[model samples]
Target: MVSELCFSDLPAEAGQGWPRGGEMVGITLEVQALQSYSLDPHYAKGLHAWFLSQVEQTHPRLSAYLHDGESEKPFTLSRLMGPFREQGGRQVIPPNTPFQWSITGLNPEVVDWLWGWSQRLPAWLELRGSPLQIRGWKVLFPPRTYSQLLEQAPSSGSCSLSFVSPTSFRHRGHHLPLPVPKNLFHSYLRRWNDFSGLPIEVDLFLDWVDREVTIQRYRLESVKTTAGRQGSVTGFIGCIQLAASPRMPELLRQQVQALLQFAPYCGTGHKTTFGLGQTRLGWLAAERVSTPRASQEEQIAERIQELSTLFLSQRQRQGGSRAEKTAWLWATILARRESGESLEVIAKDLEMPYETVKTYAKLARRATKNYQSV
Candidate 1:
């Protein structure tokens, strides 16, 4: 069945087809698969690269900052949101089905770049060799400045945040899948301090947050998924309701409200660039109410993790960063090959040389055989 597609000019609500005065903005692009295709579980990595390439084509300096800046990324991307069917362990998207993909800018420079680029967006978003036709685009989050965000925040009430995609924080050397209140606010506050130009004393504010902010209600689930090019991540996708103590000063309360409003634009945790932490302002009923099976990406991640564990156990030297890294690389190459991806494609996706990937696959196979023989 052919889906209804929008090919008209930007809607009137979009306001002048660009951001007003280059403020923070989030947009949803209406896209469709040009033909029936089996999408890779880790397609978000390709989408991330494609976006950076687009930025590089015009604003080279901004692209470099977005790519290499040690600071928080000025943007966030959402996984393609639409209908898909699993066929032979892959997500199959039907032709001409409407899909939504969101991109949000955290600062004025990035927002301005988005506005200019949207004027001449390419007809298709190239994902590896498969292409998704760009049908239409609209501003999903209204544009606003950091000061404006703070100034316009509501004076009183609880804030609810919905994490629509897998969201995790880097705590110490590992991924923290649960959204502890302090960590959740820390994520939002870091972005605000970096781009908002209104820096709050981190220790002072977070200490107050720790003592005053409380999770009123929560419904969360943790899932393991593969993202970017390397290791797997364990993250949570759910909704939480939080309230501040009434005894808190009104000034601090307003800042809390502003940061919560900023969550959708800045996202909630690490790897926001690769579609890992898609957040929204209000409670998402679907997340709270429904239970979901492991996604194809999560399933693939599980397989890789299982294989990595087996591979690590066989290694003579089993406890260092290098050993773990090698085990993961071998496991990833083998798992993708078993899933019917070509070696060259796997090499490209992992950013490894073709020869290196081929050697790892051989080594992984030999190791697997030896283990099974015992």
Candidate 2:
């Protein structure tokens, strides 16, 4: 079943003194109905990993931030889902199946970055170590407005949301984490309030403190994530409809709706970069949605390819295959520095000597400066 929820451009800064275009705004782009040649239940996870590699290949800066978010995540990815035929209880997306995927940029720079790549539609997506041609793309541009969440609450004084993919949390608990209403909404609210580049009103803050949740209907099952050195992400997937308690203050209600509207774009919970925590609003207001397609810059794809090749060659020359291992590490350190992540955190995550990571960061900065100068 297909349902649509729309969010418009909401401007947010990339953090203190980050370089960007004058008008900072958050924009989300979705490429829907990508068809593959064969059935693969694991295609979504493969696509997720391929996306990370592609980002690292094209925009190391963004890749680094996604790896090390010192401030807020500049972007989030949702898991791709589509109808699949079952074989011996295994889910297999049929050959020539149409699947949809999206990327949400939290800052104008990210949005502009995505806009540049939109021109090269119907590109090859690597899945299961093979190049799969995405038949075509239906691009959603200009982003939709998320103002419906501000409408007056129903007389029942409640709202509901649906989860279409595996959604989980990182807070330590031995048992599988059930999606709690308050915690879920609070999670979205915190991200929205922290990264949306908007100030929260006093009432909204109070509502966050006072609100509650009731899970109406749900079907949850654990799903393992893509294979990687990071191991696997085991999370829950199902449909859940939650309602707010004590009614909700007007401002609080709107803020919640707004954030929920944007949640699908900025997926909730961990491993989003690897296609975990894909979510969406169950219902939406009746409004005519429209998108503006930006004209593609000429030779942009060629330019991205050129940059990717240069970086790959540089890394290969620096340490051969060994240097490739640290490509993500250096990018993480450099990206985190801009977002305010401390050296200690980066070292721990990369499992490297703190001083060594620092030195690499310095070298990475110098290299970037040199590249730009040339």
Candidate 3:
């Protein structure tokens, strides 16, 4: 049913005029579901896997770096944005329904790789077992180098950003849902430092950011969601207006403006690659409204958090990271099992040994029973 010409089958000139050679770029792919299918709440994980697989097919080394790099990730992905119906705790997309998915690359290597990949894009994006026919694609954010962003930043003005997807920061081993200005800039600054090759003094910049930047107004709502392999996240989706004090040095103000521009391409906070922290310029009032189906994942995440808290309190050795991780792991295993997921499937998803997951599930049961009996 895909009548459009595949990218590979097109003339070479068709790929021309597309943004290339920039240090950062963002693109949105328009796709339509070929058949009706139900998706898990955490289906962003599948998108993440599919992307890495595409990179691995041609540039295995780059894929390895993207997957294993300890540095700030040079890319981010957005969850599919479109209409869906909630059915039996899952999201169901009808056949031929259109969706938009965005990807951004922050470094020259990634940008170049994205450029090359886009030239020969596959006809379909395989999510779980469903195939979404790629309809068309376009650049979402203009391609620009860090220097260009710095040079082109407005000399003085307020900036507003919309967090289109749940955005959160990791603070002291827990999720911080509020977008405190210090944390917000620190998030963008981290990525800017990692990939820009133009390093700014962190303490100096962040100090200025904290002292100079003030939140003018905000409309935010917190939501619970699952991210990455094992744990749930509590994050915010909304918009905030920020401005620097006029008395601040002009250069520092420009840097602040530049970082705000970088936000859409670099994303705002943690787990961005797994669909958190999707951001864009401007105050998007419509996105602040919540949908009923969006709460399905929140419900599951809340349950996991509740179970984890209960298990953590029961641990005698609750002071260290080990205990915290164990509690969360146990809580996740038990929660999924309660949701009718088989132990084998849960173990595979969590990448834990089968016996270890089995044992954790048993331990979690005992802990719950003890608490209830008390």
Candidate 4:
């Protein structure tokens, strides 16, 4: 089938529309079905059924991500579940080979923890369509806390303050996941634009999947001080960075959802050849959820009030990098839903997996609960 073919060989028509230096790159990723499943498009006509079937047989570690808008919520799959899992992913994916799905979105803060998550995963993600893993650039970079940790994280308070460079750190790099500094992401973006010779727009997506509604939300200040309820999706963890077009958060959102819908067919063993495919496609646009609004103080206050009642009594926690990120994600999900934005538009803007974004939203429902007593 055309979809199964390596993106390298496209129909003759795909070549006709190309302009000089206007090539599209296909990124391959591995997805683990959160439920039982198949990608044989014809196996089941019902979308939800087919999707549920497709997510079958995930590793024990990965859990179900779904939600219901009810008083006493029980996690269950919804309409966008399957398409977001098995159908919407593009040939595009992460920057390395031997693709890894240990974490969904890009969050500067989670760099250290996510890399650690990648290393510890027992089995590679198992998907149906194309199996691959992102290899090579899998190095973990320094977190916002790295410099501070270097000075104070020592158990014995000894600062072997030798030459403060990556080379010196590498000798002792066993515990230091790839020595990239927090500023590395910034520097990399500049380099990427220069290399592609294409004007790039970046939209960092922030999705919070916290179920419990608490006025006392966690923040950078509440690390150990925060309290989480039983069904609370555990302290509002989120995913960030959706590359798409500027001003179109909806398109990037769709791409994330579609990528997640097609999740059943992608996995670590899924492999691909590294090269840019012709045609600008979606990746050419470069988009992300707007940093303009939520980053503003008054908007943050507005989101807190507009959010579900479960969260009304609690704080979204923007006092620290970790907590502030959670706040942004919650705000974005809520904002998009109330506005009734189109996933296709969201995909066009973010230049990422649309289904993947939906997956994040599905997980968000389960997470953004407004539990009262907890």
Candidate 5:
């Protein structure tokens, strides 16, 4: 059973920015396995910290598992995903307005424990060291079941996605700075492998790639990271349609649907703790695209990847590791240029010479044209 609860009459500023370092726009809760519960806002106010501390005191084993999980020794849980809501129907929550937190868990024990906790809700919910009275809360359970999901799952190997929040990944030792088709699906497959508790074969999942999945109509943009003063997150935040090869197995296609549902809750990439990667199913070619539109910068990032790939393939202008570094640098600049970022801003952010970025942008454009004409 999944229950959803809503809390209103929160401090407006709390919604604008809570959990100061979280650097998130809306409210979200990262509680594990509560059948379904809703929490009100703020991390900056130490509210989340207090709540977790209480959990630690009351349920040390469960709390420890959620904070950090290890298979052996100190045994903790690492698969902690959260619930969040930024909009209610057509109306978007205004900044500093009250926000809602949706809590859910598949485990009945987790749900029972959480539901008990909510029953003991104090009269006042504290924020940033200030206490505010709870307006009201009601348990809600909408129809969400395995069968319902099965009905909604895509019948074909093809899938479309919309990254509602910044979605990035880690490839090799570095953050995958771009949303490539391989990285995106591989990340999904990895998460499913980790949490699905199913005996899925890695080769079988990889085989889906051999079917030649293609990505199209994507938009990406960079979001500021609150982790550090200069840190930023580059992620895709628009519609991307993926077409699978006909050779894809029916089982794999079914898995794709489950993966899509999982992506929204589990998120897609690194720094999900700070709310970086969020996604959902997107417009198939046949469906009318929704109204929440992509930004101009996002649209440019979509095409910029194709342009960058084209540029690199043609010139091989530089070779070796050093050459690879140069190619990435140029690709970064070209992407930003296409997104309409000023060379000066790009230079300052990348700590490069303005003239150099301008020159590289021009070269990239030329390379793109050269590749296209051929």
Candidate 6:
């Protein structure tokens, strides 16, 4: 059992509505720069086994698969089409540990060591009492992975292991940089700064990070401590699953979008996207598609696919449900072929008034301009 835990005892989750039935598996993805997180319970009630996450701001989405000590690969979990939530079985997490911590009186060398490295996050895993039991590209077999995880997890009442800097995870690998780069990890650093509720006097921040648009704030709260350092520190946290939650699929979608946007900058440290898997690349859609195209039947279909792809590309992003969009599109097509049904008959069939039917068809025809290319 780990002497130092990094989280508090899960508040008596015995009867907490979500399942803990018959030994569950879990993959806790600790996002270093994540500012906020929550999941939809409606999605949770439908998970079978595995849960995946997208890497935020890293290349090829491979970082998520690169666990602290192993190569990239999928975990032994089921893959579902829609919702994806999994039950975290019994395990001990350090108690009263604020997600962010502050460190001072460092050996000066320590500060430099903790800066600029990609493997700064204090994370190590034991799939079976061994520090390197992770799977490869092959399908995994881990009936005991949960128990092994439990054994390795820190105790709620033990010394909590945490980094002093929010970007600590960014400093993995090296002990100290010969000449530490300032503002190098500005993106990851901001997350910890805000989480610690500590004061930041730095002038520079992450690239493209609009300080004018972003808010600056910090607050202190008591948290867990470890023998490796001093007592509890007042700090900050971006997202706590315990604070709020939502479905896995939707959550995954949002993460993928964020990852695609930020991956180029996020330094790699903790691998395997928190040991789950998959590098979801959220794509972007420009406002104009080839300066608008001719409005043909097939063209409409193509336009629908393009817009729908953009909307569904990210999990959380929505545009009327698939069913609704289909119904509306079909109705629109039929309306365009209005010659087949008298407006009055069309209204009766679709269960609307003659005028309403005519109006709908007219509106749909007009909206087509927005959907297609010139």
- Name the best candidate (by lDDT): 3
Model 3: how far residue 224 lies from native, Å:
0.5
After superposition, candidate 1 runs with Cα above 4 Å error: 1-19, 287-295
Q: Write the per-residue lDDT of candidate 6 for residues 1-374, one digit (tens) a residue.
A: 11211333332221122222212122221212112122211111112101211122332233343223142122222111111123221121222212211111011121222221112232322221212111111101111222232234322211111111111122432112111122222432442233223323345322222221221222212211110100111111121111011222333223222322221122212221221111111111222101111123223334334433433333343544564454343443343243233565444434556676666566555545544644
What are the lDDT figures for the candidates, one per model? 0.83, 0.50, 0.84, 0.25, 0.47, 0.25
lDDT of 3 by residue, 54-92 (tens): 999999999999989999999999888778777777788
The stretch of ten residues in a row with the least summed lDDT in candidate 1 is 1-10
lDDT of 4 by residue, 1-374 (tens): 01221223222222222121211111222333333332321111132232223333332222132112122111111111112222231122222222212112122212222333333333323233323222212211112221232233223211111101011011221112121222212222332333323323543422210111111211110000000100001111111122322333444334333222212111110010000000111111112101111112223224433453333225555344444344444444544443344554433333437786566456545556634224
- Candidate 1, RMSD to the unseen true structure: 3.7
List, residue by residue over 176-221, the lDDT tens digit for candidate 5: 6566666766666665555444535767666676456677556545
Candidate that beats the other on lDDT, 2 or 6, i.e. the better one: 2
- Name model 2 segments beyond 4 Å from true: 1-46, 56-60, 83-94, 139-156, 173-176, 199-211, 216-234, 283-374
Clashes of 6: 44
Off by over 4 Å in 5: 1-51, 71-96, 101-112, 118-152, 228-232, 283-374
Residue 305 of model 5 has an lDDT of 46
TM-score of each: 0.91, 0.56, 0.93, 0.18, 0.51, 0.18
Q: What value of lDDT does candidate 5 attain over all alpha carbons? A: 0.47
- Give the local distance difference test score of model 6: 0.25
Clashing pairs in 2: 7-144, 8-144, 8-145, 149-254
Q: Which stretches of candidate 3 lie over 4 Å from their true place?
A: 1-16, 288-293
